[model samples]
Target: MLTRKQHELIRFIQTRLEESGVSPSFEEMKEALDLKSKSGVHRLISALEERGFIRRLPNRARALEVLKQPEDISAGKTAVRAAANSNTALTALKPALAAPREPANDVIELPLHGRIAAGVPIEALEGQATLPVPAALLGPGEHYALEVSGDSMIEAGILDGDFALIRRTNTARDGEIVVALVRGEEATLKYLRHEKGMVWLDPANSAYEPQIYRDSEVEVQGKLAGLLRRYH
Candidate 1:
């Protein structure tokens, strides 16, 4: 059986990976677990890893993947054990067998294409990396991730260095933030607006001017779905 702190840390890590596509940093884990120092968190994580509960991704910063959860003998299994076991042992296992099992959660890896500019239009680089996202973060559609490179969408709560989750779509509604490819060469993250046969890319921050283009100059690549931020 795992220690209390080990169980708590594993659950916390799983919750964080499921909620946000990123693992909690040492500082965040320390603060959440009420530990005095990061070394305590490290020891707990090491114990969990040694027990086959989680594994760290190689060459990735703060990347942790949960392998399996703590196992519990189900009521049916307990019943089978009772057939050949003593009444005292069956009675001892009754409480555990009565508890409901928690549903399994999943993590999804999204294609980490590259960075998209949130300020001025920049060349969207294509890469072969992937981001481990929670299945809960995406809906019924293909998805990808782009690291935000500028602060043009800061007012929209999208900040620089935040991972922008993109739901693959060639269409978007008016005033929705989208990944728009400009002239088939560069891509940008901005609000999409169509007016009188012209396409306008509006920024959330007033410091930047709106970019206007001909309808033929822009193509909708995807819609902004969510964001993941890492603590530095």
Candidate 2:
């Protein structure tokens, strides 16, 4: 039987692979599992591998294959149901203990910075325009929107003409999509990676090669929060 952390890590890796064909980086796994350090993530991954639940690829970054998933969901649900059925007072109080969700009808206007290239680094246009967004689409944080300008991120379901919602932040973990200012001049939206003191900007589509730069040449401006596609 897999531990809770091992089960969660495998499930997360499987979901990401199904969506983008790229396994999440260790940093992402650490964040997702709420682990305090990458070393914890490493131990969980190693345990999963030893149990024949996952395997790693050679000479590749973030290349993990999920061999099997634990039957935790149904089992956990059954256990919860059994306990809830045994305790009437707890079940009566459960509804009141649940966290309230945000209202669905609220809207917020975000600054619409000009287009950001998905294929190559380009000058991001600064403007005074704003785009009104549904509040449910964004979480708590400062956000902005940028029109996508290339097809390099198409495989990740980010198309040209789509509005890329970005969260304002100067830091990002590996395998996250971010607005990277190149040499403080141009900016592009791509997967951010740090390896061997170099910043690697990776595209979702296989046709484009990954862009490598000195760590100092790339500055993370924001992380991808969500996407808004306008049908023409």
Candidate 3:
């Protein structure tokens, strides 16, 4: 059986990957588990790796992939049998055991417009790069991508270093996450809230404070459409 801390760490990694298509950084894991340092997080990650529960990508910083949960091995041949038969009820017992199938269509590529801060607003720079994304993850619109550069939207599962797919638009609904340009000088990703003719850029993490501005001071750049994360 996995220890309590190990279980928590694995679950956190799995949940983050499922939500953002990326594993949490060492700093993120440390903060999430209330550890004192990244060393503690490193040790836990090492332990998990040694136990065959996870594997780190070669030469990549903070790159991790979940191999199998502890319970999956415990289930033994029953789990193997369940995974082989699509119609078996045992297939429902552990969804992760099944392998992922690739899409038949070609992946779509989008322009990567450098990085955007999810914390404090930063000047959005245009970069000459492109990112390949699953066709299903994109919506109908002119779309572009920006690499996230802050933890302000961590609670929303958008972590630093993940690529955010944005649907080009100038309008967004209240409480929807959007890329907002402040006075055409800086750009940020936050929950858009309009109150009494004032615009509020709300961060998902409580450590940061919300930024409030006059409606005329901000312009909606794009709405968050999807997210992409590379293992490396």
Candidate 4:
């Protein structure tokens, strides 16, 4: 069974990987969560792997693959809670309500600054690295990272697993790749073009049709500035 700390750590790692496509290093995890030492963080990670929540590769940095899919993380949480209750060692854990996290709007606050897409939930204070970006990279507003989930932007060379750097804005210029929120909790990556009172979500890929919507139902989350790809 996992302890409360272990469960929180698991969720953190999972969310970080989804946002950045890589797991945090032990030292980073230690600093992020305020652990006593890197070794202590390592122990918790090892325990998580042993319990089937994660799979670790020997000597590989950020090689931890969460065994459960991101969409099914709620189930994982329930399982971890059950496991904790069954273990006598975890009985001492009092529910530590998570501290109120800061909003990601502040520039000084840690930026979840890579691969940001429109409407993706990126909690502030979650990113580890202090981004040392060139002045050219900074836009007027804050940005976030979003892992490209589908191949809808293939014509734009925005493949799956690629990271889109998005500047937060509700307005976009024509021919720009914007993270758009469609009706029904559906977010998509597409080129935004204004036509009369309606907006058209044009995909670069020829196979997909351009989505048309009224301004009220569709929201422009941000405009894509660039992409970052990591090769393993």
Q: For residues 33-140, could you state the per-residue lDDT of candidate 2 as single tens digits?
A: 999999999999899889877777544456675555676632211100011112221111001111113443455778999999999989955988987665555656
- What's model 4's lDDT at 84? 13
TM-score for candidate 3: 0.57
Give me the displacement of residue 131 in model 4, in angstroms: 8.9
TM-score of each: 0.56, 0.60, 0.57, 0.43
Report the error of model 4 at residue 72, Å: 54
Worst lDDT 10-window in candidate 1: 88-97
lDDT of 3 by residue, 1-232 (tens): 6888788898888766544444688889998889999898989999999998887855545556676777743242111112112331211111122232333133567888889999999986578998765544454578898999999987766778877878899998887788999988899999999888899999989899999999988999997865665543
Candidate 2 error regions (>4 Å): 1-102
Which candidate number maximizes TM-score?
2
When 1 and 4 are scored with TM-score, the better candidate is 1
Q: Model 4 misses residue 69 by how many Å? A: 44
Residue 142 local lDDT, model 4: 73
- TM-score of candidate 1 relative to the true fold: 0.56
Measured by C-alpha RMSD in angstroms, how accurate is candidate 2? 13.0
**What are the Cα lDDT values of the candidates?**
0.72, 0.72, 0.72, 0.57
Q: Relative to the unseen true structure, what is the C-alpha lDDT of residue 25 in candidate 3, on a scale of 0 to 100? A: 83
